[model samples]
Every structure is written in structure tokens, then in C-alpha cells.
Target: MKSLRTLRQAAAIVPIAMGRGKGRSRQALAERLGPLRGASTKVAQLLSARDGEDAGRALEPLPLARLLPVMRAAAPTLLGDGATIGAQGRRASLGQVHRAELSDGRDAAVKVLLPGVESDLRSDLGLMGWVGRRAGRRLRQRFDGVAVDDWIAALGDELLAELDYRAEAEAQGRYGRAVSSLPHAVVPAVIVAGDEVLISTWEGGSALADAVAWEPDKRAQLGEALTGAILHPMLTDGLVHGDLHPGNVAFREDRGGEIVLYDFGATREISLPARQAWRALLRGEVPAWDALLTLGFDAERLAPLRDRLDALAALLFAPFRERNATQIDGAERRARADALLGEHRMVPRLAAPTSAIPMIRTLSGLFTILGHLAAPMELWRVFDGADAPAPALPTRAPGKHVAPALPARLLVRSFGEDGRGVEIRLPFETLPDLEDLLPDSAREPIERSGVDLGALAREAFARGPIPQTLFDDVVEGRRVELRVIEA
Candidate 1:
């Protein structure tokens, strides 16, 4: 029954993804994945960090009456006598957490896994695997067949790992001890663990989402704590809390803004080599192609571009390489990347490594948390030296660095055969949509001149929007100028 329901949900997502825009498709997929409640929903939740949607927001907690019996059964000894389990306080991907008061008068959070969730998740992954292969074959231009299999396999391993409560307890205990020196990081201690139930000391704090609206100084302080909480474990011990979403992490004003981390079920251990490569990438010391290799991209396919790889690397990683750079323009970077991949048609040649998927997922979640805080962090402080541990918060508040102001409009000027000047002005924001907005008459001439207006616009936008000529040359015997205007 579970497999059949997942099948229906999976099938429904296909048409929605094909018929709608990217944002709408993401919303539709999240809506469908929410109900499946296992590996399917886990993937949705991970992607929510990028899509700016709370995929798990709609998840309904299993009723206490339905879950209490399972908790008692899983840990009969722990639930016996004066221990009283209260209502469900949190709903997770695979389980629901309830507040419990033990006979010893200690407060605890009892997390009870839904019955047969492991088997159901396995079934869901199997079905999704089948779907992935079928879709990969049809969409051979965009997805590599083998890479698709590897990615799904990698995701399956990480998702299944979250089902083991014993493993979670161990990871949580290790992480708690690892961050003990950082007074601002709070990792709740594990009290007891059963096969399917994990009991930990009850923790109190407001969600990180709420912290976003606090004063700038407080938000910056919380951001520093969050950065430490996520980076320390990964850099020092290579153990990462895979799900650091706002719901899983909180802020305690009473505790002097300590970051309260919860939900350790998705923790992962990073390998030494992978950790070193990530540090190099973050420090902007390594080439883009090297980072790609670490990420499991196809070296053979990338070989053809070796002659100009450095130039390509500079274009791709300029934002990271520059020290004290304030803004990271992800959109423009993506557009240029799409152009490169489109021109080369190398999307299908890529490969996804099993070991790297979780690391990437961990970083994606961390950046999302940082984005929410929306404050300038002295990120370089995290790696002041080659082997530095996560450093103490800087004595000074985060510095304010202003980016160059964006241009208001784009001006396209051309001279007609009669020596008349013709001009077209477009809103600055429409630069990204330049490809679609151009008519055949104008686009054909630009294409003939071997100039890709879309890529040019993206690169210009990324270089910081100021008064600059985007394109200037003769197109079909007519002098043309395309530039962004400050006004």
C-alpha cells in the first residue's frame, strides 16, 4: 500500500514538473512529497533550503494516542512506572517527538519512529530509482544515466541512516562533546536510546526563523553562533549535522544567544580528503576544476576544456576567491554556468559521487541558514590558518561593506542605414530575460555577430552593475552599443 501511494505521488509530479515554471514545479513537487513521509519527503525538505519553501511545514504530527503505545513498546523499561509521555511537540521526517517527564522528575523529549517506516522508505527509494532510470533515459540530453543511479543510491544511504535511533544517539553525543568548548553552541544531551525511540533532555529555545527578525546586532551574534555550530563539527571531527534547518536549530536569549541544535538523526561523518578539499574550496585556494573532480564530475569530459580551464575557473569562482567580498550573486553565476554547459552540451557527461552527496547537502543547509540571518559574517575567520579550529566570535561586530549600486536600465543603440540612431531601453532587471525578450530581427543579428547577449548580460550583471558598455562593435555594417545606464 505504501509503495502504491508513493507511485501515484511520483507519477503525479512528472506532469506538474513539465507543465509549470521552475518555482511552481518545486511547489507542486513539495506538495506531493509531503504526504509520502519518508525518503521522498526527506529529499523535499533538503531541497527546501534552496527553494525557500518549508517542505515540512505542513507535516501533521501523529496523534499522541497513536504514538504513545509505540514509544512504550520500543522502550518498555524507560516508559514504565511514573514516566508520563505528553502530547507530540514536534513532527519530523520519520518520527514525532513528545515531551515526557520521567519518574526521577527529569524532563525528556521522546522521539518515536513511525512503525515500518524503514521498510516504507526502502520501498519509496526503489520506486523512485525505477522512475529515475526511466526518466534519465528519456532525458538523456540533461542527465547522465549512471550519474542518476549513483545520486539516487547516495541519497538512499543518507536517508536510511536517519532511521536508526541508536546511530543518532551516538552521533548526537559525539557532537555535543565536540562543541563543548563553544559556550554559544547547545547540543542537548542524550538520555537513553532504544531500537526505534531516542530520549534526550528537553531543551527550550525560540526557532532560528524568529531570530531573523531580531535587532541587527543580535542577529549577527546568532549568525556567528550558527556558523560555528555547523562548521566546528565538520572541520574539527568531520561529523556534520546534515539537517540544520531553522526548525532543528533554535536561539535562546536567556542563555545569552546560544544556538540550540536539535534533530541529530541526519548526521554524517566526512572523510579527511573530502574535508581538506572543501576547506580549500571555501578558502578559494583551489581551482574550480579540482573542486569539480572532488565532487565526482567526469574528468574525461572536462579534459577537452583543459586549455581554457583556468579562465573558466576564474569566471566561476571569482566571488569566492575575492577576500572580503560582501555579496555573492548566485543568480548571475548560475546563468553563466547554464550558458557554458549549454554551449558545451556536457550536462549528460557529469557523475555524482556517493561520498560527496551528503557533504554537499550539509553545506547547502548551512548556507541557507546563513542566508536567513542576512548579515555579513567574517567567514575568513573560520579559517584564519590552515589548521585552525572553528574560531571564537570576533571581538568586533560584523563589518558593513556596501556593494556597488545596481544600474537602473539597459540601453541598446544602433545606427540605421540612413545614418539615424535607434535606441531601445529595457529595465535593468530584464537583463536576465534578454534572450526571450529579443525579437528575431534583433536576435538574429546578434547571433550572426557571434555574440551571446544572454551570457554577456549575465557576466556583466555578475561583475557588479555600474555604467559599462556590455557590447560595442559593428554588427552587419552598423555600429551598435549595448550598455547598462546608472540612471
Candidate 2:
């Protein structure tokens, strides 16, 4: 029966995955996945969160009709007499929350797993495992050392654990107690826990989306609170809140502007050594190769690219390395990351430790939240909890080679009469291969336009890797613009 359900769900998803256009298909996929309410929905949320898509934002709470029975069935056992579960509240991939009045007259938030969601999650994971095996094979051709199976299993384990509200309640308790020292941080106290339901103190706050209207000072305070709330526990105790989204956080201006955190189903623990090494990396010190290996890279696989470790580490930890109060540019970050991967064709070679996957997810969620808050944050200060200055860009210790910063990119964009066009972005390191890399159609036109590709590249290199327009011309009825950009 589970297999049949998995098949049916997979069948339903095929059209959306194989849809015709990127924009329409993504919207269709998001719309389709939002209501599924299982691990599948989480896939959409995580991907969209990373890419800055609105898919996760569009998730609608389950209608009360679908959730009320589950709450009522569990209410007697969990809440006891005189308690009442109220209207449907926020929705998550695995559960939905409702406001309630407990028997003791205390307002509470009741979180319950969606009906049959456990089975749904198992089935979805089985399907994902099959997909991962197929993808793993293709990936192996490119990256012989990538541990795809381990990654998929780790993800499956995290998602499945969320169905156990008993565990989530405990995780919330731990996180709550850990963050108690932060005055502006709030984690609702768990009132009761059952197999599928957890009731906690009902927190009152406006949605995180409401922060846009706040004064700059208020937003900065909120950013500091959020950073402290997330980092303090992770750094001090190695306990991490792995699932964070706008819906999972709230801002309470009424309560002296508390940052209310929710949904502890997905969490992780980092080893103390790993935490220390990561701290050093964040502080702009390059750790020893053994220390870096402990942070989840596959040692043998990383050896081939060891020469570029400083640059890779710097790029990966860019958020922490920056000293200024600035908002991260996700697109630029992505472009640089993509260029790095392309430069080394390192996608397959680079293996993330299974344990680090959740940490990566946790960081992705944090970055997303901080991005939306859009306040000038001295992130290092927030991380250090002091007026510590940002360390200089990472440099190798004496006698060790330091890889230069990742190169800037050259972007070539062309539009036809009907506005259809292609944009090619190449890392500056690829400049020597410019003619070979360009398609014949693009190459022919540029050559005919009397622009010497080799000379142009040499001139750009002579001036150093900086942003400048190299070529902008109308050739053979095509409007083409080529420029250097720092990614």
C-alpha cells in the first residue's frame, strides 16, 4: 500500500518536474508540492529557501477541517478535561499548529503531525532513495568520492524524526533552556507531549514579515537577537536548530521586541572540536588540514584540491569574513560558487560529511532569515558577542602557499531581434580559452565585428581582474554586451 501511494505521488509529480519552462514549471511545482504536506513539501521549501524563491512563502495552513479531528482525538489524552484546541494556525511540511486553551486556563499552541504524515514521509523517502541512487551513479562518474547515499540517508533520518512529536518537545526544551540567557530570545515552553502532538505555551508575536515596517534601530536589535539566539546555543553547546523559516519565527514588539523561535523538529549536534575549528575559520584563521577534514570534507577527495583550500575556505565563509554591515547578495554568491565549481569541475569531487548536511541546511535557513530582515548587521560582532574587529582576509601561515581570491567573471549577453538570447558567464581564469569556449555563432560575429578576442583578454588581464566593459556591439543584427563582473 505504501509503495502504491509512493508511485501515485511520483506519477503526480512527473509532469511538474518535466514541465516546459523554468518559471511556469517552478510555480506549478511549488503549487503542487505546497498541499502535499510531507517530505516532498520540504524539498520545495528547502530548495526555494536556498534559491530565494517564494515557493516556501506560499504554503497555506491546512484547513481546520483536516486538522481538527487529529487535535480532538489527541486532545483528551494530551490536554485533559476542559482544554480546547482552537483555529488552525501556521503550517509546516510535517505538522500544523493551533492555538488552544488548556485545562489550567493557560493559552497554548498545539502542534500536531498531519494525519498519515509518517507513512507519507516514509513513502516519500523510499522514492527519494531510489532517485538518489540513480543520481549517485551519474555523480560518481564526475566525483568518485561523493557520498550521495549517506547524504540522502541523513536527510531522510532528519525528516522522519520530525514526525515524533515526543522528540521535538524534548529538543525544544533543550533549545529553550540554552537560549534562556538571551533576554530578547523566546522559546515557548512545552506544556505537554504525546506521540503525535505537542502543546507549548502560546507565544504572541507578529510575523517576521512585519519587521520591514520597523525602524532601523529596531530591525538591528532584532537581527542581534536572532543571531544570538541561534549562535549562542550552537557555539556554546553544539546544539543546532536545523529547521528555521519565516513561519517558524516571530517578532513581538509588545514584549520589548522578543524574537520568538519555533519548530525544533530538525536539530543537530556538532562535536566540540568541529565547533572550535569552525570558529577559527569564521574568525579568519585557516586551520590545519586535519582540522579542516574534521569539519566534514572527505580528506582523500580534498587532497587533489588542497592547493586551493585557502580560497575555498575564504569563499565558503564569506558571510563571516565580511566586516561591514551589509546584506548578502545571494545571486552574486551563487555565481561565484558556481564559477568555483566550474573552474575545478569539483562538484563530484567535493564530498560533504553526512553530519554537515543538516548544519548546511541550518545555515541556509539562517542566511535566508537574516537576508529578509535586511538590517546592517555586524555579523562577526553578533557571533563574537563583543566589539571584536573582523579579522583580515584569510592568509596561509608562513611557508604555506595561499591561493588568491576566486577570480572575477566575464559575462557575455546577446539578444536577438525578438529578445531571445543567451548569457554566458566565464571565470577570468578561463580567459585563455575564450575563443574555444564561445559557440561558433557567437565567435563568428565577434570576429567579423573586428574585435580581437586574444588582445581584449590580454588587455583585461593586464589591468588585473576588475569590473569593466570589454565589448558592447551590434554584430549581424545581434546586440551583444560583454563585461567583467566581480562575483
Q: What is the TM-score of each candidate against the true structure?
A: 0.71, 0.71
Give the per-residue lDDT of model 1 (tens digit) for 191-310.
Answer: 888888899998878765577778776776777777777777777788878777656777876667788898887788876655665666565566645655554445545555545555
**Candidate 1 Cα misplacement greater than 4 A, ranges:** 1-4, 17-23, 51-53, 138-143, 291-297, 301-323, 329-349, 385-487
Least well predicted 10-residue stretch by lDDT in candidate 1: 393-402
Model 2, residue 84: displacement in angstroms? 3.1
RMSD values for the candidates in order, in angstroms, are: 19.9, 19.3
Tally clashing residue pairs in candidate 1.
Answer: 0
In angstroms, give how far residue 483 of model 1 lies from its true place: 52
Q: Write the per-residue lDDT of candidate 2 for residues 1-487, one digit (tens) a residue.
A: 6666567556646655444356666555556666666887887676556444434457677777787666767667546678776764667788777888887788999888877887687667666655554434546565641244445545766787778888888899999998998899999999878887788999877766678578877777787788778878887878889887666778877566789998888877776766766666655565535445546455545665566666655665655667773455656665766775555555322445545666667766777777667777766655665323322323212221112332233333322223333334444566677777666777788998888988987865564433334564567866565544322
* Separate clash counts for every candidate: 0, 1
For model 1 the local lDDT of residue 106 reads 88
